[model samples]
Target: MRVAITGSTGRLGRALMAAFGDAPFTGPSGPVGWDRAAFDLDDAARTADALLDRDRPEVVVHAAAWTDVDGCARDGELARRRNGDATGALARACAKRGVDLIVISTNEVFDGTRRDGRGYAPDDPAGPANAYGASKLEGECQATAAYDAADATGRLAIVRTAWLFGPGAPDFPHKIVRAGEKALRAGSSLWAVGDEWGTPTYTHDLAEALVWLVGEDAVVAPGERVAIHHIVGGGLASRADWARDVLGRVGLDVTVDEVPGSTWSRASTPPAWAVLAPTPLPGREPLRPWPEAMADYALSLRRSRTASNSTTRA
Candidate 1:
């Protein structure tokens, strides 16, 4: 399989690159990576042209989007253009060229009003509460519309995930650990929201699933050309719970103060119940629990710190 990944510099994109590195895949010369400089999503016309004229991979993983929730709330039009229009352009190009597409989406599309403590399935109704989620939902619509209009014989899968944490980026786990260390130094405690809930997914694990989706071994059910799949960590956690778990894994003795989600002021209002029930591909097991993945991330951080200290000493 010839695979191309957009947003090559992002946390998930980096993991996808690393995951595909071990697989029997290649582009014209090697694996195709399109960072912002190489493929700007904002310029829809140019993006479509580039995809149609220049890089023609067998599968294009559309991962580029304005992921800043607060920023999206501040500029809804920008979000719509980047996330919605850009995705439409890419999808149209892919549909026309008969290239398979894997669109990476978010769990924010749902309204998060479920009080039953159950995870949102892929087929659940979407009612975005914020500008970012609305924009992503629009993107999903555009992609589907494009493929439908073209009647293209290419596979299209929308993967919705949540709370991704991994190495090489300051993700949620890293942020919590960093804040906890700072608070410990100040002899204080860290504060986290107790109401907001979601599953903390690992980027590497999600990337592996995507690899299988694009590989020959993956089975697309009959009459299912366009499908949606929820790929997330095994269990769920509130913000405070995630914070405490991260701190504990990293050996931080700082206390975590559990607070209400309302106390935290932000431009975008995240879903209060953001959990997603992962629907793994057939024959593939669900991702491991988040705590296990967090342990690996903590160990990686320690190794990195140790290597940096050794280099400094040398």
Candidate 2:
């Protein structure tokens, strides 16, 4: 299929590119990496015409957005344009072209008000407390609306994920690991927020699942014309606990000091708990646990550094 992915250089976008590159997606033109330079998404009509005129992709994965939580809180209008308005425009463009649309969203759509701590289901009500979450929720609404306006045969899937970590992106888990290593070297304790809890998703796994959803009939038989799935890691952890785990995996003897989430006062309010419950598909294996994925990720980073060091020495 002719796949087009926005935010092609982003954390999840890079993974999507890698995963789809490995998959058997036959097209007159391969996957189009549509970055910000391609078109101004803020202008819906112009964006649609320009993108369609350039690359008529069969599948469009909308992943670009203003993900900076604090930044979004500071500038609500920019956040709305990038995350909300842009997505709606993209969805409309895809619908008009009869292209399958897969919109990558976040777990922040919830207000962090879950008492059960079991995580938010796809069908649960969304009440965003911050601009970031609010904009994403709006984007979701717009995507659904655009899909509804399209012909009944087209597909639109909204995949909500959380706490994503991968090779290329500057994710929280990797940052924690780096900080722990530094603290270990300095014989100091690393401080992390204990109050906030969320699921840690591996971008590699998430990307593969996205590809499966788009094409692999063996993995998921299409049950809904427009589907919503919660795609996240199998396990949940507090920020401090997750940091401590990363430290342990990296063979660091440093202590991780647990602090309140409120201690790191920022422009936006964080969710106390925003873990996303992964939806099970028909023939796919369960996603690996967060701990397992983290361990592997840590080891890979180490290996990469070692290789780089060897090359430098030579």
Error of 2 at 71 (Å): 0.8
Best by lDDT: 1
Q: Which residue runs does candidate 1 get wrong by more than 4 Å? A: 27-30, 217-219, 304-314
Candidate RMSDs in Å, in order, are: 2.1, 2.6
lDDT of each: 0.85, 0.82
Q: Which residue pairs come into collision in candidate 1?
A: none
State the TM-score for model 1. 0.94
Candidate 2's displacement at residue 92, Å, is 0.7
Per-residue lDDT tens digits for candidate 1, residues 1-314, read 67889988889889988888777765335567888877787787577668556876878888888998999999999999999889888888888887888899999999888999889998889999999999999999998887777766877888999998887658787788778768987999999999999999999999988887777535245677688899998899999999998888767899999998889789999999999998867778899998888877788866664675588789
